[model samples]
Target: MKKTLLSLLAVVTCAYSAPALASGGTEAPPHVHWEFSGPFGTYDRAALQRGLKIYREVCSSCHAVKHLAFRNLTDLGYNEEQVKAIAAEYTVTDGPDEDGEMFERPARPSDRFPSPYPNENAAKAANGVAPPDLSLIVKARHHGANHVFGILTGYEEAPEDHPLADGQHWNKYMPGHVIAMAKPLSNGQVTYEDGTIETVEQYAQDVAQFLAWASEPDLEARKRFGISALIFLAVFAGVMYRLKKAVWKDVH
Candidate 1:
């Protein structure tokens, strides 16, 4: 019995420690309060807009939100003309013409965000590893928003014991404590028109929120529907109870 208990303890320890070990003793991401967290939460339009700016100015050079369409900007409070203007900024490759030749055209609201590179090989050649698409990144990563925020702000000097290669960077939240991407955000890197403080932490937080919204654009609607359903159920339950009392009162 003692041996069996010891075996169970070993298994639990291994299961708990394996992730840390795999990540080279990387620390867990810190919790961040998000506007869209609770059941009554909704995406902040201002923050989403700011995040869009960051992605366009900084992240768009490498990463693409391929799963998102220009039309989807409406969810961020952009109007029809505004969305069209934004879409026009990008060039998209379209279908073959009558002569069997693909043509380039200004992107429309229906078009997906184009990748920076023409192909995977080009992206890999440029960045070593092709940057992952940001469309579903929030849903893809564990503790999505917080993890992303941690990574963006986690860069620091490596300890004497841990050396890094030429292209590698040290990040407190990164697995293995080594990352290929350098610190991307800097103080005052992007100017904000809304008079929001322009800092690395603020940028990280805004972009994380934006990515979260992107991952689940219907989050607000879904929550609203759920709340309505619950209310309806409660009302129906109450009405049914009263009707039962009325119908069975005489018999009882």
Candidate 2:
């Protein structure tokens, strides 16, 4: 026990003394109070629809959501007919007929969202850096939606002392404060159907929430199951407690 205590103390001392490897230039991402944050939270369908519009009209040019299918839009309060119409807006490559030739067709509800660039090389050639797939980005990083929201709204001018690399933009929330992508959102960038204010912050929050949904499509169902399981466990525990009390009461 003495040796174990000493060893544990030594380890704790080492951990405290060790230098953390960190990017010194970046600031922590700003936190947003999201509607779908907690276990019982649910998504606002109106915000999600607006977010989809932002992605389709603005972010789609450079970013791609290959993991998302057109049918998934139904979760954003879109009906079958509306989803089909939205899907038809994009053209997707299709297989050959009897001739075994590839063809292009209007994307169907079943089709995955088309990538903006054909390949990584193509994306790099076009954008100088490969644009990341947004399908799971909100869940991919620490702080999830809050981090993404910060990135979208964090652009600013660099101070004179800090020089940014060519093609790199200063993003307050980005590690090293240098990001390849410029600020994507602006005031009035997306006119919401529900007449929500069109500010960069609003756009960022909505889009981040939408990305979170994409990352966890079954979040609501999963939470429901968790609640049901907890209830079942509680009932089981009560029954077990009662049985124990009844069996042991006479002896005690």
lDDT of 2 by residue, 81-147 (tens): 9999999999999998679999999999999999999999999998888989999998788669988
Question: What TM-score does candidate 2 reach?
Answer: 0.91
lDDT of each: 0.92, 0.89
lDDT of 1 by residue, 173-211 (tens): 988788888889999999999999999999999999989
Best by lDDT: 1
Model 1: worst 10 consecutive residues (lDDT sum): 17-26
Candidate 1 colliding pairs? 23-176
Q: Cα RMSD for candidate 2?
A: 2.5
Candidate 1's C-alpha runs over 4 A off are: 1-21
